[model samples]
Target: MGILSRASYVIRSKVNAVLNRSEDPTETLDYSYEQLRDELQDVKQGIADLTTQKKRLQIQKRRLEENVEKHNDQARQAVEQDRDDLARQALEKKKQKMSQIEELEGQISQLQRQQDQLVEQKDELQRQIEQFRTKKETMKARHEAAKASARVNEAMTGAGDEMEDVSRAIERAEERTEDMEARAQAMDELRENGALENQLDDRSSLEKELDAVQQDGEVDAELDTLKSEMGKEEEPTANGGDEAAETELEQELEDDTVSDVEVDDSEVEAELDELKDEE
Candidate 1:
């Protein structure tokens, strides 16, 4: 083919492809149905016209028959009155009318045949159109059902464009959530290791150190108070009334001192463990 012909062919192919993509089967079927109905209407109109022509021909033939009967009467009267020329003229006119009637009958017969053929064709075309309409509706219903099923499948499988977009969005959200969790865990680790300080705290480093020293001094004072209370509870109240009692009191004081030392050490260890946990 020539370049122009090839170009035309390509254009036509592209147009057809576009049309196919854009065409709705339901709408196309309806359009075809309408076309068939319009054709049926045309055929009915044609039959009606043919019938009207036949009726006109029949009416003319009836008038010609009436004229022939009138001519016969006139010819009979003329013979009775001995007027043969008038009778002969009337007979000639009647013959002409009869000939015209025969022609009209032939035309009417032709019109009747055409009308009958057209009516038959119209009936056949209408039957085909009805069948097509039924098939078209069934096909349309199937097409609609298929479309609905396809949409449901696409949604379930996440295959459609909107579903894909939603899937991506969910993935992005999950990634962001994981990242935030990781960052929070890292921050907690840093805070626990004293690598990161609380931004909300207003105290300077020197002030914090001073506060720590003050807290330690308070703990030491509380420990001293506790030790004095224990010492008072363990002290013997006996006067130096007997040597045995005095010796026993000394022994008890020594044992109490050893127990107090052990308790003090335990209390100190517990305090240290608490401080470590807080840090």
Candidate 2:
């Protein structure tokens, strides 16, 4: 049983391999339909040839039969006249002609059988081609649908990446805005607690120093004494000789002699007389 089964499996495998090599069912179906059409044409030609041959054979057969009938009639006449040799020759020719007619009839029958078989095969192949065409269309539609689904999934996934990036960007912007808001609130609180006022006093001190920088020391001191108390420093003078010495030193530096002119009572009287005259 196993050997038989293995033989049958081998036969099926060979048939399947041959079928696979011959053509792809989808492609073969199309080519088979074309070949079937050609085969049908060949069948038509074969039928026509067979029909013509059959007609020719029938005509020949009929002519041979008529000859045989005429020969029989002649043979009957010959026999009535007592000539047996001519009648015997006529019967022999008739037998040979009948054999040829039978041969022609057999050939026609064989050709007709082959033509019918070809026509049946053509029809069956055409039906299979149509079935394969429908299946191919379904397969093509499935492929297109799968591709479209993949594209849709890819587009959705790409959009998800963009949405993630946009979400992160929005989160960063919100964080920056919150940080700025917090800083502004801190500044406001500092102002409310007099810390900002203390900074203003520091600025006022800088302005006062700037104003005092361009003034003379006494002026700065007077302004400072207004802010505080004033203190005085003492100095010393030598004597009454200091004034006479300073006058003599001044006349000597100027190269003028004090005794260059006589100081007389008459000159004093003259200066007094002039003063009296002017009065």
For TM-score, the strongest prediction is 1
Clashing pairs in 1: none
- How far residue 49's Cα lies from its native spot in candidate 2, in Å, is 5.7
Candidate 2 lDDT, 40-60, residue by residue in tens: 667667666766776776677
Candidate 2 residue spans exceeding 4 A from truth: 1-67, 80-82, 147-279
- C-alpha positional error of residue 239 in candidate 2 after TM-score superposition, expressed in Å: 51
* Tens-place lDDT digits, model 1, residues 100-179: 99898888888888898999999999999999999999999999999999999999999999999999999999999999
Candidate 2 lDDT score at position 203: 62
Backbone clash count, each prediction separately: 0, 0
lDDT of 2 at 132: 63
- The residue ranges of model 1 lying beyond 4 angstroms of the native Cα positions read 1-7, 141-166, 218-279
lDDT of each: 0.91, 0.71
